[model samples]
Target: MKTTIAVLGAGSWGSVLASVLVQNGHQVRLWTRHPQQAAELNNQHTNQHYMGDYQYPPQLQTLTNLAAVLKNAEVVLFTVPTPAIRSVAEQVVPILHAQKACPLIVHASKGLEQQTHLRISEILTATIPAPYRQEIVALSGPSHAEEVARKDITLITAASTSLAAAQQVQRLFMNNYFRVYTNTDLIGVELGAAFKNVIALGAGALHGLGYGDDAKAALMTRGLAEISRLGVALGAQPLTFIGLSGVGDLIVTCTSIHSRNWRAGNQLGQGKKLTAVIKDMGMVIEGIKTCQSAYELARAQNIDMPITEAIYHVLYEQADIKQEITALMQREGKSESY
Candidate 1:
């Protein structure tokens, strides 16, 4: 059966997922804020800004008109950056009418807003009416867009307040190369998905400094500890961090050369300025911005997250990277188990 999916963002990840849906024999309409980009995709069957090399189906509708694309969508996949989620949600709320049966709303974005400090799901629930609240779900995991777009084997998870909603997404999306799992721990999934990018920056920096695998491994281990600690403090299950969204995502983002966050951190570790690093990477590095938000959340929650704190200083305070490394090394030792 073919389902109609409206993908609300035509970035690399969005385009990749749209193409995946097309592969699954679904009708996919990819929406972009840039009219020119939408025109190109609609006419050329290719997204030059994001997935330039990959060819999409001619049937895939690329539209700048949000209302038309979303009118009767069976599933609405929001793939914009975290910063843009609130405004987009607000804009779409009025268009959500009662006459038509509502669709499942899924968020593929990772990161909390720095100013509002609200997670993506929270933003959706606050913006959408109560009737549509239960339909929201977050789909995330270790799967990278670059790899997944290439039709490589990738595994991801769909989390929702209702297990039935999660299972619906899992059934709708699972494929031979693309595996989807269902989990009810939305907090753990969202937090782990968002925070791992911050740690990936540190991981990339370690590699840039000519650090050995042992050093990178230690940083990743400690980073997960801090992430798990904070996650549990904020109502997430402690063991959720060990699952696909936690350790799975952390390892992939930290080690992959394709990861924008890791690439940005590499430049930073090599002594490039923050502005210069982002300018060179040429894409959204969620981890850099996420570090700031995570730092703020840690402070607000009174949770100790030394790794996130150190990265925040490096990003915003102009702290010397070498000194930051030394500071982490000099911290008092504690029991290995947290």
Candidate 2:
């Protein structure tokens, strides 16, 4: 069955997802705020700035008008950055409220709102009225846009409080190259999605600091511990931390050059300023902001996340990376079984 989908955001992830929808025979209308980006996607069928040399499916239409994109769409997927999710949700509220039937709201963003410390799904639930919303789903995993663009096999989890909603998204995106799984632990899935980025930043810094595999292994392992700790504290299932959105995302983002967060951390490890690293990346490095949010949340929850604390100090306090690492190592040793 063919469905009309409205994809908000025209970046690499958004364009790649819209292309996937088109390939799946859905009517995909991607929304972009920039006129030039919209024109490029509409006329040239390319989003050169994000997905270099990767031509989008011509069936994928790009538009600047949100109303037109949302018109008769059965699903509205948001691929915007974490910071923009709330604002975009606010913008979609009035338009969605006017529709006779509420569309399933799905978000692929993988970070928490900084100040409020709310997950993407929570933000959507708070902003979108109940009458205008059917279900909120989070689509996340280790999948990267570049790899997906190359038709590499990608598996992601579609998490919702409603199993039916998760199954719906699974059917929508599953194909030859893309695979989807359903998980009902919405809290666990969202936390795993958001917190893994913080661990990835630390993993990249370990590489940047000339650490060997032993050190990287230690950072990643302990980082997973921190992720699981904070995640469980926030009502996430313990098992979800070992699944795709948790350890899976951490492995890919920490080890791959394709990750903007890892790349930014590498620059920071090379002694570059955070501002310069972010400016040069030409994209949002979500972990930097997410680290702060996680640090604050961990403190509030009384969860001890030493790795997150170390990375937070390095990124926010301008602490020397080496010094932070030393500080981490010098902390009182405890049994790993804790």
- Per-residue lDDT of model 2, residues 84-106, tens digit only: 99999999989987866599999
- Clash pairs detected, candidate 1: none
Cα lDDT tens digits for candidate 1, 197-307: 999999889888889899889989999998998889888998789999999999999999988888888888888999998887777889888898889888988888888
Winning candidate number (TM-score): 2
Indicate the worst ten consecutive residues by lDDT in candidate 2: 93-102
* Candidate-wise lDDT, in order: 0.87, 0.91
Number of the top candidate by lDDT?
2
Candidate 1 stretches greater than 4 Å from native: 98-101, 132-134
Q: List per-candidate RMSD values in Å.
A: 1.4, 0.8
